[model samples]
Target: MSAPSTPPAADAARRPARGRPPRLDQARTVEAALVLLDESGLDALTMRRLADAVGVQAGALYRHFATKGDLLTAMAERMLADCSTPPPDPDWSGRLTALARRLRTALLAHRDGARVYAGTHSTGAGTLGFAETLIGVLGEAGFGPQEAARTALTVVHYTVGHTLEEQAALQPGDQGPADPERLREAVADAGLPHLTAALPVLTGTDFTAQFEFGLGLLLRGLRGLRRDGSGPGA
Candidate 1:
């Protein structure tokens, strides 16, 4: 009798697993990637690394995500979940403020989370829907589409940028002037009278306070622009 023929590689590729749970889908893979990201940071994440974390062949991931960019995009969408809650009734400004706070809190929760966010455009359905809701609220509040869109983007940019800087602020480092004495010495050497005068005000204020202060400035400026048309010949 002829020896039993072995299954060809091509044939095996077409066959399904008999009893094991179905292989992970894109969402599961994405979540696994995010878990790895939280633990290992964005720089250390690789397809091989993710598959190993998820207990699957690296090749199995390709069945879900075709490329790293695809995986990154998926991760970015999950980031928006923190910020994309439904609007609270009759309180648009409150709604917007709450949204920004939520986004900031969520981004701060992970290691280099904002970096993942910054890498992706993050204009997926969930984000766009949130954007639409924001735009509609702003429009009803007397802003045009152009103004609303720009304002929405500004809020998002400020939120992400502030959160990134906050993360850096908290990371262990000697980047800040090491002490009050060092700060005084630097200020005295520079002889910038303004810096010396403001040192006390600036010294103790942490990132949370700075964020609200900066947000107020942007929001105030936007309001001023709307009211007085802060432009030439307006």
Candidate 2:
């Protein structure tokens, strides 16, 4: 019998899928990261966790993404992937409300939920897409470029802020409501009388009610801007 013949390099190259698994792209890696994020909060989303979630080694992730920050940027984008540039509309109030709901839904779906969305990561399409939608909606509301930009920023800022607060206040099936005094004393007695008196009407309610109230106030403020150039419009 001939001595064991070694396979040629070309033959070795033709090795079947039994050797190593296919490589994951940035998106796939990030998708796995998101899944890990949903299952465990951000604090728990180490490379090992993501790798385990994707059925790969931690080192494998570095092939597609450089570091955790890069992974996070991708994950953030994935969270808001469904949202995109807004279209012009006559019923901007409804449009705004819809945007708010969509945003709330997107943020609430993940673990650590809003904690994952605290700040900007400019490299992500998710952030850009959300910004584009808000700007377009505000522009359609009779706002000029600058006005629309600021208004969109404020709207999103408020949404993120409120969403974070809402997420922090409750857990799965916990009836624990927000401490109303937290919202009450937050308003100054002298300079912020309106906010003070409106405290019970505002913070005393459930998150759903509070969300609607704040959104209504935000929209009402825009109405004043629509009528006069006073709101960022000026």
Candidate 1 differs from the real structure by a C-alpha RMSD in angstroms, to one decimal, of 9.7
**Weakest ten-residue segment in model 2 by summed lDDT:** 9-18
lDDT of 2 by residue, 86-137 (tens): 6345598888888887888788888766777777475567778788887777
Worst 10 residues of 1 by lDDT: 8-17
Give TM-scores for every candidate, taking all chains together and pairing residue i with residue i.
Answer: 0.77, 0.73
RMSD of candidates 1 onward, in order: 9.7, 10.4
After the best TM-score superposition of candidate 2, give how far the Cα of residue 107 lies from its true spot, in angstroms: 0.5
Q: Candidate 1 residues 174-233, lDDT tens each?
A: 344236677889899989899898887556537788888878787767667767866212
Give the Å shift of residue 140 in candidate 2.
Answer: 2.3
Candidate 2 local Cα displacement, residue 105, angstroms: 1.0
